[model samples]
Target: MSNTVVNSAGAGLVRAVPALVGAAGFALVYLVSGSISSAFASSPAPQPNVSGEETRAWLIENATASAVQAVLMLVSVAFLALFVGAVAAITRSADGPARRWAIAAGTAAVASMIISAVLSLLVGGLAAGLTPDAVVALRTANFIAGGTAHVALFGLFALAASRIPGMSRPVRIFAIVVAVIAVGSLASLAIYYASILILAGRLLGMVWCVFAAISLARRLKQFPPA
Candidate 1:
């Protein structure tokens, strides 16, 4: 029983650490980016319309913050890889469909995180030095990648978790709720181009991580030590 507790603790860490790191990254993005936008723009704060030179200046001025954000995102994703392992470990006791969905969800999420980190890093480096058109192009890449894959994959994860007969009802039900939110998030992005919706989705996604981690930890507690 002690062994089970210890291993469950480890699995909990595996899930929680990445979500925490990722949360920190998002917080930094909001703080750093929001400040930069306000600093560079006039009243009304339509930052998306701010000039490329201003954007470049902010990137250069806050180079360290930009660097930190990139590092935090990368760190988050790295631990996210461990979270994948945790999910896989849990799936060993789950049915075939649950296992398959879990793997697919993990793969998609890992891919999204990698893409988000790499593109954002590249844009941060290049946007500050490039032409206006070039800056626009870079920003476009930054905007477009995650809607189809990232949140959708999370919805898929929710479905898989709900199907896992081993988990408790509240856990499964919450998974389904989160899946619905994920779908709404995607629809908001697709139909209205609402960036705030995306933000809400991601924020809720982290919350889901916390709850799912707890659920998975409980499941892991039932595992016998090898």
Candidate 2:
């Protein structure tokens, strides 16, 4: 209702728009790149426990697709960074705990995106030149960093956002659920079968961001932040 809140809300809405576009962009990139990689690859896609030879072969065959995926992933990370900033701005007017949650969310989001971006760079720029064992090691690290760690930290962000006041009940609950799934993805490290949890959590988290962004935008328009 105050001028500060109004300005923060306005800025948040502006940043939230990128979350929507980033989500869509990531999804499209995955679909297109996944298809291309699958089509070009002689071997199956690399798994968490993939063999060195298999990963090297896949990397060699799909260098172009991997590069494309990496470039787009970096772009997605930038958008995600913007979204985190947006959430922080929107919560700028909140009380102590809420503001702290926003800060935590921002931190977790940044960490997640950074890990993912680094993995993307490794895959895009360095995979081809590495030895088989090194490829396997790096690829495994990338999988853990980009998949399990990324989603789990992102879940922390969602959990933090869920604690913020004024989000719709459904959105809050959804965020909590997404966070649980994402954080739970850590189990994948121990239970390879649990990798499904990582996939589910990551996909749902992206959707949750878009939903929250839209909800924030609607609230801003309805209340005019003042």
Per candidate, the number of residue pairs that clash is 0, 0
Question: Which residue runs does candidate 1 get wrong by more than 4 Å?
Answer: 1-54, 146-148, 188-193, 221-226
lDDT of 2 at 154: 80
**True lDDT of residue 144, candidate 2:** 77
lDDT of each: 0.60, 0.71
Candidate 1 lDDT over 92-178, as tens digits, reads 655577867877886777678668657667766766567876766565555555444576676667667557656678767777777
Best by TM-score: 2
Q: For model 2, how does the per-residue alpha-carbon lDDT over 54-114 read when each residue is reduced to its tens digit?
A: 7777777777667666665667666677777666666555546855775676566656656
Model 1 RMSD in Å is 5.0
**What residue pairs clash in candidate 1, if any at all?**
none
lDDT of 1: 0.60
Least well predicted 10-residue stretch by lDDT in candidate 2: 217-226
